[model samples]
Target chain A: MTYCVAIRVDAGLVLAADTRTSAAFDDIRTHTKLSTFEYPGERVFALLSAGNLGTTQNVLARIARDADTPGATASLRSAADLFEAADYLGRALVEAQQKANGAAADGVNLEATLIFAGQIGTGATGLFLVYPQGNWIAASPETPFLQSGELKYGKPILDRILRPETSLEDAARCALVSMDAAIRSNLSVGPPIDLALIRDGDLRLSHRLRLGQDSPFYVEFRETWSTELAAAVRGLPPFEWEAPRAPPAP
Target chain B: MTYCVAIRVDAGLVLAADTRTSAAFDDIRTHTKLSTFEYPGERVFALLSAGNLGTTQNVLARIARDADTPGATASLRSAADLFEAADYLGRALVEAQQKANGAAADGVNLEATLIFAGQIGTGATGLFLVYPQGNWIAASPETPFLQSGELKYGKPILDRILRPETSLEDAARCALVSMDAAIRSNLSVGPPIDLALIRDGDLRLSHRLRLGQDSPFYVEFRETWSTELAAAVRGLPPFEWEAPRAPPAP
Candidate 1:
């Protein structure tokens, strides 16, 4: 299990993912779930993945292998637009799952869900959520974010704070706070966390960070957020009945 | 789907539950999920429920009926301690589900989960989470809370704010905040929340509140929480690389 979120703000896109993968409680491992595709000033894409490790790895590996091969038919570089890039990713995910299931015996589901976020050749910045069924949906103006895997614990913050006009830095901080909430509430999602900021129209990555468990920056972020949240709770108005209580009968 | 939570603090116990119940999108209704059993100064118990509405209603009705009947075996009033009451409630739940499932033809589950919170006689005040399988687990000093149904969205706040030394009012506030979070993140959990507070050693009820959708206090609470949460997000520290960025290449 993992938690990955991508927000499309007016200034840029912010994408983040946790690194914990657990087949079972005892079989947990840390794996990077964020993959980036950059063609310098031409195009850039960041793929945040969650689901069956083998399937995601295979899909990612296939995409990278294609990119490395000169004149490959279906690579991020070959997509004509952000929509086409999402479609290509969905196809790769389906093919990878089908190929893996074909070799196995039982009725196991090797489905994987991904967030395709980036800029494509000066096109409007985009964020698409690719489903396990080889289809995708892009974030709309009203809802400028997409998330997958262990999402609920971290979602309320994003729903409250994110908007198209939110600054790039604020969006990135919101993502980190959201991820921190998820990591605290759930065991399946852990650090190190991977984050990337792609500024709108720049076609170049502004920030790419990997925060391990003991990283000072991540620790401070978590602690400051926690303290402020507690303070927020403390500062809420008192309940109507809080001050006026009936006396206990003698 | 529903969301019910119980938090046990040194001052007392705080329990809350949403009122939404849905079999389908079109089949939604508001039903009270919080039940209280009070023997006045001798004892008081609050039961918060989630899961199959029919099963929960049946279990609740049976518990009430047994208590009304004279000399009924294993009624809530007859239980020796909070643990015994939890055990009795679990048995009632299992009995109700088995009775319902026995009558149904298709493979339908009539399972229900409940949080049994209150004091029994002069014994220790307690909170127990009763599972669908008729087993129960008590909340400890360290954990101090139990939640059921659509729980993840609201859990991070509880994990951060709840402690053995938290005030009853604060605990109730935390419960409301948690419930609000769940309601916002998931459609299945909705308004008209019920809250109850039981002070340890007091034995009688301290506070019982039913917050309807249009209730002014509820509305105020929700607004305050949202505003404070947004402010908290704004106050988070900026990313380390946020200030230093190279200009885009010409």
Candidate 2:
């Protein structure tokens, strides 16, 4: 299980994911779920994934292998646009899933879901969510964010804060808080957190961070959010006919 | 789809639920999912349910009909304690689910989950989650909350704020916020919200509220939470080398 979210604001795109991967309760391990590909001024892309680890690894390997092939015209490097990249990735994802489940009998779920966001050219930024079934949907002004795996627990904050006009840094913070909410509520979404920021019109990632539990800024970010949320809850108008809250018992 | 949550604290118990029920997107309806049975000076119970509406209605009807039977020793009135009440409710749920699906051949889900909290006597308050299969588990101080249907979206706040020493008023407020988060994130969950509060060491409900979208306090609660949550996201510490966030476009 995992939680990954990506937001496309006017300023650019922001993507975040947790590092925990759990095969079973006792079989948990840390695996980075976000990868970035930068061709400097030509193009830049960030891919975040969740679901069967093997399938994700396999799809990603195919993406890297094809992109690195000399004179390749069908790889990420040669995609006509961001939409084509997502479509290509979806095909790779389907192939990987089928290959993994081909050996296992029935009940083997080797599906994976991914968020693909990047700038294919100047003024051409896009975000998409590729489903396990190989279909995909692009984000629009009406829906500026995409998520995969354990998405609901983190959706409310995104619903309230994300907009096409939101600043890239603000969107990154919102993504982190959303991930923090998922991590706090579910063990399967542990940290260190992975975040990638692609500033508008830039052809490379402006920031790529992996914040562990003890990272100074990460610690302060989470603590501040927890305190602020508690204060917010306390500040809400009370129901009519309610008395003042009493202090806790000793 | 429904969203229901119940919290047990030192002061008492708080339960809240959304009323939206959707069999299909076009067939949406509103149905109250929380009920209270108060035998003043003897016992009190608040039940919150989620899943199949027909199955829940059937189970509740049986509960009411059986409890009303004269000389009955196996109804809600006859339960010696909260555990017995929960066990009884689980059996009723299983029976109802089976009956509803018995008419269909297969692939028809008729299951419902319930949260039952009550006090049979002084110092006898307890909370239990009754599963669809006639099994149940009590909520201890270590885990003083039980939720049914669309639970994850509302859980992070509870994981952070609920404890044995929490005031019932605060717990109730938290419950409403939890419900608000679910409503904001999903169309399957909507208003009016139903909330029930049971004070410990008492034999009757202290508060029972049905809040609609237009309800003054409910509207204020949602608006304030949204404002404060956005502020929280904006207040998080920025990463190294980050630029100041720009204001929204005019």
Candidate 3:
């Protein structure tokens, strides 16, 4: 299981993904689920993936290999815009699935979802949720955030706090808080997070960071949030008992 | 879809359930999912259910119908203790499934889960998560809470705050806050809510209240919690940029 969240805020876009993957209780591993496709001055596309690690890795590898080949099928660098880049990536995923489908018939569930977002040339910064079927939906003003894997646990905070006008910094903080809530509640989603920030007009990645368990900022945020929540609950008025019985018989 | 949560605290037990049911987007309805069986000072049991509404209603009606039949299948009143009562309820669920399973094959998805907790004749106050199979597991000191239906959204707050030593009033408040979080995040789970509290060794029903969207206490808690969370986030130290960026070329 994994948890990845991305927000398209007024200031920019914030993307965060955890690095833990497990097939069962005994087989747990850490693998980076965030991959980047950047052409320094022209475009920078970030992909946050969840679901079958094998399928995602294969699809990503194929895209990279194709990009390295001279005059190969549409690569992120050659795509006219972010939308075309997303389309190329989606096709890459489909090709990978077709290659693995024969073996997947024997009980293996090969499914993967990717959140593809970034800036391209001077066109509008795009954020899309690419489906397993090679289809995608771009985030709009009404719904300015996208999440994949173990999303339900962290969705409440986002639903309540996220908006199109939210600042990038605030959105980043909320993303971490949401992830903290999910990690505390679920064992499947563990530490070592990958985060990337892309500003609206910037053709290059603005801020990218990896967060581990000992990351000072994350630790402080978790502890302070928990403390504040407890304090908040305590501050609420205690229920007023309308009827009181005599002291319990000794 | 529904959301129900119950917690066992040192002071007593707290149970809360939503009252919304929907077959799809357009076929939503309101129905109470809480059932109470009381014999005054002798015994009291509150059952909070989630899953298929028809199945749960049938199980409840069956238990009530068999309460006075001698030599009939075991019922809540006929059980020897709280554990036995939970088992009997589980069996009742299985019975309901058997009666409705035929319809299920034709497309109906008949499933139900119940959280049963109460006191019986000065015995230990107990809480159990009764499954659709009629089997159940009692809550313990290690894990003093149980939730059913749309549980993930509300689980984080409960995990962070609930403990065996939490006070009854605090536990009730926590339950409401948790449910509020779930309701905000999930469209399927909504209000009005039913809450029941049972104090240790009292052997009788303590407090049961129904809360709606306009319920004063709920409204206050929701508003206060949101404000407190925003304040807490704002209080956190702002992320320090290691280096200032150069002004973009005009």
Candidate 4:
């Protein structure tokens, strides 16, 4: 299980992913789930993946392998727009599925979900959630976000805090808080987070961070959030079952 | 879908459940998932359920119907301890599944979970998570919590805040905060919550609340938590991305 979220706000986009993956309680391991494609001022695309690691890694490897191949149908570099780039990714996923289908006959689903977002040119920014079938949906101002992996645990914070007009810095912070909440609750999602920020129209990565167990900011945020939450809970008026009743027979 | 949680702390026990149920988007409705059986000064048991409402309702109805029946194998009234009551409830769930198996073949899953907690005799209070197959596990100081239905979204807060020494009042407040988080994130878990508190050795419920959309405390808590979380996020130190050197002129 993993938790990955990407937000498309007015300020830019915020992307975050957890590193823990587990086959069971005993077979847990840490693996980076965030992949980036950058071509300086030309294009920048980030992919946060969840589901079968083998399938996602294979899809990513295929995309990277095709980066330098000219006229190879379509590559992230050759795509003229974010939509085309998403389509190229979708195609790569489908191709990978086809190649792995024969060995995966025990009904193990080789599905992988990708949240792809970034800029392809000046004044052009896009965010898309790509499915295992290679189809995708672009995020709109009304939604403003996309999540994959073990998303349910951390969704409420996003729903309540995210907005189209939210600042990039705030959105990124929200993403981290959301991830923090997820990691605390779930064993399958642990430390060492991958977070990225892309300012609208920049066509260059604004921030890429790797937060591990010892990250000072994360430790402080977790402790402070817990303290404030406890305080907030205590501050609420105590509920009474019934208006003070006199003792029956002392 | 549903979200029900029960916590056993030093002060006592806290139980909370959401009311949303749906077969599809258009087929959604509200139903109470928490049921209470009170023998006044003798015992008080609260059952919070999730999954397959039909199955749960059937299980409850069966228990109520057999409450006064003589020699009933494991009726709650006949149970000598809270553990026996939990076992009875789990058996009732299995009975419900068997009774509905034919109907289930048409698509519905005749499965449900029950969180049963209360006091029996002069013993300490106890809490158990009952499975559909007549098996259950009691909450201990080591774990101290149990949740079912759409559980992932709200689990993080519980992980960070819950402890064996947590006060009953504090646990109740934490439970509500957790539910609020779930409601904000998941469409399948909604308002009109069922909340209850049981204090140790009291043999009577301290607080049982049916909090709805119009509840001022709930509304205020939700607003306050969201605001505080956003503020906390902003307080975190910002990521200092490495600056790139000047690129060649176009």
Candidates sorted on DockQ, descending: 1, 2, 3, 4
DockQ of each: 0.68, 0.66, 0.50, 0.43
Error of 1 at B62 (Å): 2.2
> For candidate 1, lDDT tens digit of each residue in B86-146?
8899999999999999788686768899999989767778999999999999999989999
Global Cα lDDT for candidate 3: 0.84
Question: CA shift at A82, candidate 4, in angstroms?
Answer: 1.4
True contacts kept of each: 0.72, 0.72, 0.50, 0.55
Off by over 4 Å in 3: A65-73, A102-105, A235-250, B68-75, B102-107, B236-250
Instruction: Report backbone clashes per prediction.
Output: 0, 0, 1, 3
TM-score, structure 4 vs. true: 0.87
Badly placed stretches (over 4 Å) of model 1 are: A68-70, A244-250, B243-250
Which candidate gets the maximum DockQ versus the true structure? 1
**Candidate 4 lDDT score relative to the true structure:** 0.83
Worst 10 residues of 3 chain A by lDDT: A240-249
Give the range where candidate 1 chain A is weakest over 10 consecutive residues by summed lDDT: A241-250
- Model 2 root mean square deviation, Cα atoms: 4.2
- Go through the candidates in order and give each one's C-alpha lDDT: 0.89, 0.87, 0.84, 0.83
- The share of true interface contacts that also appear in candidate 3 amounts to 0.50
* Candidate 1 CAPRI grade: medium
